[model samples]
Each structure stands twice: as C-alpha cells, then as structure tokens.
Target: MYTKELFHSWVPKVLQKIFLFVLAIPLLVGSSIYTANMGDMYSGLGTYAETLTFANYSSTIGMMVGLGVILKIKPRFKSKNIIVFAFISLGLLTLAIGSTQRIDIIVVCSVIMGFIKVFGMIELVVPIMFIVSPKGDRGEFYVVFYPLILGASQLVGFLTANLAYNLNWNAVYLMSAIILFGCALLCIALMHNKWTAKRMPIKGLDWFSIVSFTAACLLLNYILVFAKQQGWFYASMNLRLALAAFIICAALFIYRQRTAAIPFFSLAIFTKRRVLTAIVLFSLMGMFTATSSLQSALTSILQYDARTNATINLAMIPGIILGGFICAMWFKREGSTRSLLFIAFSCFLLNTICLYFLISPVVDIRYFILPTFAKGLGMALVYISGGFYFASSLKPTELMGAYPVVIGIRSFIGTAFFSAVFSWGLYQFQSDSMMELANGMDTMDAWVQARGGGMQLYASVRTQSTLIAVKELFGYTALAGILVLVYILLHPFHHLHRRQLIIRRKRLKGESIDGLRAESFDGKDITATAASVST
Candidate 1:
C-alpha cells in the first residue's frame, strides 16, 4: 500500500467533506452538458441534428456500460487516484470534442468520456452519501442528492447557454475542460491517495456483454434517430441494416447474460413484479419527459435564441427543489411509493395539459413557466421514487447487478427510444399539417398577396403547422399520462404489508426496534443494506 499525504492535518474534516461535495458537482454536470446545450452545438458544430442525438446516445450508453463494471474496477485503484485520472481524461475528451468537426470522432470521444466520467461520479457519490447521512440514513442523503443533481444540471445548462450565446458553442466545451482540469488539481490537493477497499484483481467481468449491449444500443439509437431522415425502415437500406444489426447484437447480449458464469446483469432480477412495474413506469416517465424536446420547436417557431430558451428552462429549478423536498419528506414519513408515483404522474399530466394549450406561434415565454415547473417537479419525483421502488424490490446480492439496467432504462434506452419516436411522430404530424394547411391556402392566397405574398403565406403555413403538430403531440401525451395516473391509483397497496413483514422479521432477529423502523421505511436503506451484504 502507498501512503501519500495531501491535505494538511489542520484542514477540518467538515471542510474536507465540503470539498468532496463540490468536486461531485462538476463530475455530474460534465456528463450531460453537451446534450443540454444541443441547439448551440447544432448551430456551432454545423452537424446534422441526428449527430447530436447520436453523441448523446453514445455517451449515455458508455455510462451504462461503465456502471455495469464499476464494482469490479473499483478495487483495482485508490479512489482519489482513479478520480483524478477520470478528471484528466474527461478534460482531454472535452477539448477533443471542442476541437473536432468530425461526427464520428465526437461520438467516439463522448463514449470514452462517459465511461471515464462514471468512475469519478461513483468515487464521489459513495463518499458524499456518507457525509450527507453519517448514520447511513438514505432519506436524508436523497433529499440532498436529487436536488443537487437535478438543480445543478439545470443551472449548468443555463450558464453554458449563456457562455455559448456570448462566446460561441466551442466556448462551452473549453469551459468544461478547464473546469474538469481544475477539479483534477483540486482533488490532488485536497485528498490523500488511499485505497478504500482491498486491492482485488479485475476478473470475471463479462466484456462480451458490455460490447454487445453497447453495439445493440447504438444500432437501435441510429435507427430511431435517423428513421425520419432516412424515410423510415423500409425506405432506407441503412435503416434496414441497422435494425438487423441491432437485433443480432441484442440477441447476443441476452444470450451471454443468460449463459455467462458471471453475467454483467443477472437475469433473475426481472422476475420481481415490483422491478417490472418500475421498468414500465420508468419508460412512461421517459416518454413524458421526452416531450421537453418539443419545447425547442416552440422556441424556434417563436424565434427565441439559445439564451432565451435556456432562461425559460431555468424556471424548472425551483420546482425541482420543491419536488426533492417533498420526496424526502414523503420517504421520511414512509409514504406509499404508489402514492408518490401517482403524484409524479399527476404532475406530468398537468404539465402536458398546460403545454397542450400553451404551444402556439404567438406565445409569451411567461406562459411556459408553469408547465416547465411541473415538468421539473414530475422529473424529480419520478427519478427519486422510481429508483427507490426499483431498489427496494431486490435483495442486496442482486442490486449491483441490476443497478446498471435500472439506470440504462431510466436515463438512456427509454429516453432515447421515446425521443426518436416522438421525433418521427412530430415530423409526420408537421408534414401532414402543412399539406392540409396548404390545401386550404388558396382562399388565403389573395389575402396573403395583400400582406406579404407567397413567402409570407409559406411562413405562416409552416408556423401554424408546427404549432398544430406540437399541440397534437401534447394532447396525445396528456391522454397517456391520464391512463398511467389511473393505473397508479388502481394499483394495490402492498408495500405496507411488506414493510410490516420486514419489521417483524427484524424483531424476530432481535435487532433494535429503532434501527428496524429506519431500515424498513426507505428503499435506499434497503439498498445500503444490500450493498453491505454484497461487500
């Protein structure tokens, strides 16, 4: 073992904790900054819109892949040292992305960056959880964690947008690189090089599953993102080929998972009813949240610049904070996960309804504040509660294996899949609306001629069609939200019985009543207990 002192003995432990907390912010923000500032990148990088989505997909898939192997990788190096390496790697990758115009290079860099970024995050997150909840109370930790991640992301998006607006999109990447490099230096200065666990050889990892799953996801992403541009599956040979490749890769991944001696993800977790329900809910949440992409359409139609659109999104921060607060309180009180989900879906439904009416060619930014708040609130609730629901369903032995799947569905696969579907739906709706409007435009031609002639008529038709398509999409999402909300309401309340059983079992084991109560109340506690069991 190597011992290297970094922070002086005089540095207070509280200050060290603060340093860890601060170090975590950049790691979380850096992962999704590019996706958050998509519009600016589209204009500045001069890449096809699908290229941005592909980059995002690649990064997300990379993160998912990284997470699958994190436990196996962690014991190999000192936590601080690995984090510093990740920071340096991310810094270089950020610069690489900024310096490149090649779409393929951008995507490849994003994948590597995403993979490296998660190591830094996991190193920081475990420590932060301890700091936030010294006694290992996960509710307290989540109260801080959800708001910090969600709110900081929003704030970073706004700041990056401002940076892009004032100085070009490349400036955002430069700024991220500088911040990452700065974090590396800070980590070196503020932390000692020490291993948290015994050094174990990296072994038994299923690399085949990782590669196959990544290929499968990327191929599916390509098909979805390019489906509209390529004229759907039948119209484009590339789409057909991508679909076939995706099918083959997916099959290979599943086969390996089923047969491997030590699979990347254990197939048994899917047998849990609560886990399956969580997956479905997560998919719906992704679809509902994906509608936020349409907000860009509203902004574009209204001619809002990148800064203005970002400013509008800033309205979501307060609601995110509020949602976090509510979730924390709910968890502390041992509230029903079903009830929490109902509230979450209700927020989504409300947001959808608000946007359904609010999207139009002529609309003020102020009109978006409510819907944006609701969207943020819904996102926070779903994220926190959905994770709890999923984690609570499994034993500790299964958690590390299942966690990557949960994150993959919640953050990447589900969101990306719906985003593509919505994109295609929007395109079809816009085209159909335009054709219908154009067919009726002869009566307005004379009127249009009196105003600004053919150009004005075309612009008017285009704007109206976009607004109509967006509204129609929102209307459909609203209906889906309603159905989901109803399902949540009708879902049986079995969690209470399960909690009672846990409490009884703990009592029978002669555990402290207070500890049993605390442990049985929150899924995060279950997760922590599970982690302890696995370790």
Candidate 2:
C-alpha cells in the first residue's frame, strides 16, 4: 500500500484527476461484465469437460501471461502507451467474442482478450496514479478509489445481469463492448504510467505453474458447474479431465513454488506462522460460509427443486446486507475487532449448527432462513475483524501486499478449489450411502425414496436430495471451520499487531493531530482507526 509521501505534493493536478476519473470507470466494469456473463460463459463454452477445460485454460493462461507481459515489458510508472494499447485490445477482444457460441473461435478470441483484461487490471491503475498526485494522500487516495473500482464491478453486475437476460446475449455483449470502448477512451485521456520509473522487481515466468493452475481452475469450474448435469463421473469424461487437472495443478504448483527463483507463489510467505495460520483460518472459515456454492448446497438440500437451480440459491443476500448494515452501525459505535470477529465466527459456527443439527426434514422454509441470514451477517463481521488480524500480525510492507493477495487468491482460486472439494466429498459420501442403502433393494422406487427422492422421474424429489446432500456439505464445511479456528488461535501475528499498537500509541500521543497517523497494510486501517476513535 502507499504512504503519504507517495501522494503528490498538493492537490492532484486538476487535469490529471479528471482524466483519472474517466479512466477509472470502465476498468471497474470490465470484470463485472465478465461476472454478469459468467454463468452464460460456462454454459456457452462447450459440452464436454475438455472443451470447458481448454476454454478456462486459455483464459487463465492468457490472463497470467498477459499480466506477465505487462509487468515485464511495461512494469513501471512511465508512459502507458503500451497499456492503452493493451486496454483497447482487451476491451475489443472481450467485446468481440461476447455472444460467440463457436467453441474453437471463442477459445482463440478469449486468449487474445485475456491480454486485454490483464492489461487493464495491471495498467488501469497506472492512469489513476496521476490523480493521486498528492503524495500525502497516496494511501488515502487508494482507499477512495480501490472500492470505486470494486463497487463499480458489483454495480455493473447488478445492472447488466437482467439486461443480458432480457436483450438476449447478442445486445448484452454489444453493450459490453460499448462500455469497454468508452473506458478505453477514458484511459487514453486519464491513464498514465506513474510507477513506470520506480519499478517493482519483476518475477520470471512459471509456465508450468501457470498452465497447471489455469488448467486446474478451469477443470474445477467445469466440474463444479456441470458436474450434476454430467452426473459427476458416474457418467462422463469430464471427471477424468477434472481429476487430471487437479492432480496436474496440485503437483506442479507445489513443485514450481518450491524450486523457482521467484515462484508465482511463495510458501515462504507462510513462514510467518501467523500469516499461514490466518490464511488457513480464513480459508477454512471461507469453505462453509455463504459462498455461492454453499447457497447452492442449501437449495439442493432444502427440496427447492425447480428447472432453475441457481435461482433458488439467493438466500444469502439478506444475510450479507444485514452484515453490511450491522458493520456500518457497529463501526460507528463500538469498533471492536475482537467483538466483531467473535460475533462473526460465532455466528458462522452457529449458522453451521443451524445447518448441521437444527435443520429438520419436513421443516418449513423458515427453518432455513436463520442460517443464511446469520451467514451474511457473519461475512461482514469477518471483513471488519479481518483488518485486526492483519494489523496485529504482519509487518507494514507485509501488510501492504500480503492480505490483498490473500484476498485475491481466495476469491479467484482458493474459494473455487474448496468448493470442488466440498462437493466432491458430499457426492462421494452421499452416493456411497445411497448405494449402500440401495444394495438391499435394487428397485428404482425403493432406491430413489431411500436416497430421499421421489420414485417419479419428474417429481420434485426426483431432483432433490436436499436434506441428505446438504447435511454432508454442512458437515464438511463445519470441519473446515474447525480447522480455521485452530489455525487462527495458534498463529502469531504479533509483528503486525505491534505495528498497529505503535500507530495507535502515536495517534493517542497526538501524531495524527493534523493528518492520519495510520499507515496502510494496503489501507486496511484506512477508515478503521477513525471509526475506532469515533466509537
């Protein structure tokens, strides 16, 4: 994260700030467009696991390689001509192939677009740097803008999802292109390479890890998204590819990081037991919480069978909103990290309890309500308290890049992988139970009914073993939650905690009399300390 010295001497040069505002808008939306069409892309990519795998493979590799190129060739605060080129190229590439159904062409075009998206992610900020011209506001500026980008993504996702649905995929993509091009024009005006001169050391390429990770991710996506449709290898080639992808990815990822001079991942980062523990705990807690997959589990187990499965999975929104609202209010009053974390973890465990032992078969939907609502609230609590763990744990520099990477990896890869594991575990356990029970009868109705489904092929229960499968998913997630609790408890984050204490001491000592005494572990403390003081 940035310190005050990183900001411009005074106000951002007006022209540059305006230019950055223009540049920031679309780079934010590009990903949302991807997300809005995320479900569509999976369905549209291809039929088999191989096609989907390659589709994902191309996107992942392309994005990584593209990001690598940007970091290598233009890794700086210099003139962003190359970045501008990358942005337009990716935007057009993304726009061009949005409605495409042809699998081969989609893969090729997606690879090309990968470069564009990667470029935007890496370089879009290049332009925004000009706006943060006030060196003192560097950290503060990041606080203001980073969420602008993320919030915009959410906004675009919400805005476009229905539009895509209503207009057919054709106009949706066309609109995506138009929005991107608009962003490109903004970049041309606002985005400049500010960090071009003070370059961060560029790491070399890890083709094996890159390919393997990408393949694994894509494989996982295919397996997760289409597993039920394909019957989870009880009936498909996709399973073979998925197993291969996971093995290849896991093996290569571990090997490359262990040996590479500058590995894509650093097992060493976890040398700080606290960071490792935090990652483990966060990851564990993440496994069962109101993730998209968890919500899906809820629907699958709750007998909410419909032609549309994804739709039944929206129980977590109210929970999330409630969490956000509680956080907003609570942060305004008793900004207690310990309290927030306790509430979140407790609620999370309690929600697990709700799903685990309390949920009953033949229960009202109301029985299911509390679990998701609690989950949503819990996520907010974790987010706020997550700041404290990071603060109390790592060094300033470590804090800057450390947790953000955790955030990114968790969102991008970690969550998905765990999701696959959860589902696979459920399938294995449930299928085995179903088989063991059915072994006695060998009759269709007896077997179906025993598995908790109706004998009728078209009946609601025909598609749902909601209670059975969910109990399994919840059981797995709960175990993960336990792992999280243990790791966090054992972990040592005293280094960052010391830093936070020092800052708080200085602040109380009147260091922030005119300005914030807080330094960013990538701005986690940005508004937090102020909120704490107010409380």
Best by TM-score: 1
C-alpha lDDT score of every prediction, in listed order: 0.80, 0.54
Residue 12 of model 2 has an lDDT of: 60
Please give the distance, in angstroms, between residue 361's alpha carbon in candidate 1 and its true position after superposition. Answer: 2.0
TM-score of each: 0.91, 0.63
> Could you give candidate 1's per-residue lDDT for residues 123-215 as a string of tens digits?
777777766776765556776888789898888888988888788888888988898899999888877776566789988788799889889
| Best of the candidates, lDDT | 1
lDDT of 2 by residue, 1-535 (tens): 2221212334366655565555556654554225444455555554553354445435654564454344444443344555566556765666657756676776777666654665555444544543443342232333344335444544555555666566554566677667666766655554443443555555466678667656665556566545655777768887777877788776877788788786655566677654664565466555654344555555544555321332322445555555655655554453544455656777787678776774344556666667756765566556544644544454433443354346534443455556566666666665666655545543356666666554443333322444566676777667766665555455443335556677678877876544435443422443322111100
Worst 10 residues of 2 by lDDT: 526-535
Worst 10 residues of 1 by lDDT: 526-535
Query: Candidate 1 — what's its lDDT?
Result: 0.80
